[model samples]
Target: VGVCVIPIRYIGRKMLARARVVQSSQGDLSSTLQENFSSQRDIRAFELEQQQIRLFRDRIRRYIQASIGAVRWQSLLTPLIEFVSAIAMAATLLVGNMNGMNMGDFAALATAMYLCYEPVKKLGAVHNKAETLNAGLERINHVLNAPDDVPEPENPRSPAAWKGEVEFRNVCFGYQQDSPVMRNIDLRIPSGQVVALVGPSGAGKTTFINLLCRFYDVLSGSVKVDGIDVREMSKKELLSHIALVSQYPVLFRGSVADNIRIGRPDASDAEVEEAGRMSAVDSFINETGEGYSRMIGEMGEGLSGGQRQRVSLARAFLKNAPILVLDEATASLDMKSEEQIQKEIERLASGRTTFIIAHRFSTIRMADRILVLEKGRVVADGTHEELMASSPLYRELYNKQQMVAEEEGGAPC
Candidate 1:
């Protein structure tokens, strides 16, 4: 019986190690499938059908191999235990005969050994199950036990007055510690001001807004809303005062009205419809005949890009926050739609602090002030006319865009 247990224990260890590999390979295969599913359009457009198919096949093969390896060890455990038990029984019978034991004595001893063998076999099966379960739990715990990079404040503070004034004092930040994306940024945006951020790609325009929103903390200096440092305020309270409409907005599976009402959960049906109307969402909803009750698929599927942009704008309108951030809010719209939404955006920006991040000079024309960034620093801060005359970098960017618009037979900025 003791000799029988040795092989089971050794094989159990091998099963445990291989089980981890199987779990990891299974996760990798699942992630690849999800990525391919979500990016079907890109896959077709890039003509990568064969490549993706091959990659998926390789992952499947790896997953199968890992599974087989784990099973090999597990399957060996039961058979090896049974084989050892047979040898143990044979050895007991031979020893009993050599010792001149009576048949009754030998039978009793054999019965006890058989009962013990049954439990040992059952325990070996249980051990195999336990190792497989442990592998999955380890993966889950890896995520659950990960450290939070953005920790909450020990004592959160709220502003006595919620003004729209935003200030960045010598702010510096980077996704990586040694390589800074934005450096020595200092600016103050007063309430009711409309500021446009423009630059060539890789400039710090998005990073500036990210820091102000506290999506990431600045490595140096501070961002202040009203008179309080944003780090001192709770994330929820700070975000409540700002409305952001990104280039690509995410909409969940729900009715159009339900998606819009996410801006203000307590908003009435009338208020939601009003917001939809303000953002020109009502026009298309009416065309569909379902109006506000029209269902939106996951990630705003089954809706055109322009319609998704309008829905996102509707949310911002419903929120009516004091601070508005539009990151290429109208980029997805056609000329006619852009014209209509531009008017709505102007109305929404009235008496609110607005920050617009756009590459289109037409979009930035309405901005009271424009800040041009180069590399990681603000290179120019002035109106359109002032920038064109004084800042060569800004002049070159605007002129290039203007020339492209002319070549494309679009209206000049």
Candidate 2:
């Protein structure tokens, strides 16, 4: 064991480093694969398949080089350990004879030495396993050792209730310091008001909601909930006041009942059913003969787009949080489904401070207040009619959207 230990520690340091490199390369390659697959349609439409393939092949080659380097070091350790064990055994026999050991004593020492070989062999086997598994270990340790970008307070306060009045005070942020996502933004929404955020693709609409949820610490300024700084509140407190229905509703692998119950774990069967009914999914659930027993695949893969959206809405209904945020919530649905959800969305927004981030003019037209953003600034704030009269950007976006609607032959909302 001693003979094996010395070589494994000293000779294996470089091997561990190589193993980590291999793991990181594999991770990078996997991430690239996921991105490429998710955007395959865009790549094909843009005729960039060859470009993507070239990049992917380059990543794969790097992964191959890293794997070979790691394996080479691990393979070297096993032979070196065997050579040291053989020498140690020979030295032990010679020393025993020179020290004048009797035959019986020599035989006993010989038996002990043989027993030592078993553990040393096992240790060598363990070393090989460790060398390969270190690749996985490095992946785990990277996440574990990473510094938290958003950390909880040492002593966190969970508010019992929030009035849902949101305030953004001189707020600013950037994923990179040189390019700000939101800039010196100041806004206030009264409790229970329905607000719509309209902006060009990169005008920080999503970033606003992220800051509101305290997903990242602001580089400067503060976002408040009911006059309390969101950063000061615990995660539970921050989540309790908001019920979110995103553009793509992500569901876990569970019975339909289990998924709906996630919003309020203590909800009874009747409560879950009522929430589903309100969200317009109860009829379909009962028709499938599964009622609440139906199991959904990951990300609700088996369900229709409308069904998934309603499930998320059902979750919000059950939670009954004071703040409702629907980020492109019904954008993927068909006209029929969109209309159904729009009614549900209105019901969901009633008497709650609701914020929506859909680009469709029809969906946001009824909002009590609309904030038009451009280049990280709120360029206009008003009711839809007021915005149409006041903001050229809003008018241009609305006219383009109306033309598209006309071409699609759908009546104006």
Candidate 3:
């Protein structure tokens, strides 16, 4: 029961965010635009953003419909409970008749006992079943009405073209009130540099990335990009400057072409196919029975891990953003696949500010500078050779990754 309520946190957050979007767009939702909503506004446009909220509401409504069915099933149990109890009492009365107790005495007993049993049994049955359904309804209402995460401001300034310098000045943050995950983090990444972030689990490496994305604002201090506070920039403008490919790739249900085109929605078919070829997905796609038109199932289920990574790389290529974040983007690929993808990344990384987060030291060896983090602090920052001499933590992590590679009967670089 406790575990069941955990997912409600995310569900409630999404629903509330959607509600805000809808409320923000009401003035723009005119009768003329109602007929062809998509044609009138882009999904990110203020007017159409409310559709996400409506979709969320519809989802909850559908769940409520299903819950009603469950409630009916629960109610059916009440009649069964009464029937069983009544039958037991009736058998007791019949036995009394066979034992030669006077029929009048048995009739009096039955009449008096049933009067107590019926009301008591019915009330107990109704209350028990009602309580169970009440819990379900409470969870439903919680998910549908929980308060939202603090929202970004409306009509924020659109940031100018970025030079990719990022600064986190004396930042402190915690998801909860009493405990801070990152404490007084201060760092800077200059333009056109590749910085690698590496740390053990829960050391706040990913949290740093989240701050850069502004997914959650800092508790104190600021994250500035190109000398301007990221919080002041319009969310769309801030995100337009970056492309991210994480360890777990995400793909929607669509043809291969549609997946790649997500990076640049207006990309021509030729351009989309070319991006796939650059990512080394094109050769396999051409050999596929359906070519680029082949449908990728939910989350690219129909494709191999390597295939999915290549498609994600193709998306980054299509996005062609100035700031690139590769969060172990090639983590799951075979050596041959990694080598091919690395070449593509190297080609793209020129003249762009890149942040590479990798557990494998081999992946970060080529990075211009490695930022070693420990307990939310930058413990060491330098090149691979420099870190080997200066930081034992970096060396230990590097040697561990090397040991794993050797244990798998693979050659170490």
Query: Which runs of model 3 end up more than 4 angstroms from their true locations?
Result: 1-150, 407-411
Question: How many clashing pairs in candidate 3?
Answer: 0
**Candidate achieving the largest TM-score:** 1
lDDT of each: 0.90, 0.84, 0.75
Q: Which digits, one per residue and each the tens of the lDDT, describe model 2 over residues 183-237?
A: 9999899999999999899898888888998888889999888877887788777
Query: Per-residue lDDT tens digits of candidate 3, residues 55-130?
Result: 6456556555555544454455445545655675677677996898887888787777667655654554555445
Q: Give the residue spans of candidate 1 off by over 4 A.
A: 1-5, 404-413
- What's the count of clashing pairs in each model shown? 0, 0, 0
In candidate 2, the residue pairs with backbone N, CA or C atoms under 3 Å apart (3 or more residues apart, or in different chains) clash, namely none
In terms of lDDT, the poorest run of 10 residues in model 3 is: 1-10
Return the candidate ranking by lDDT, descending: 1, 2, 3
The residue pairs found clashing in candidate 3 are: none
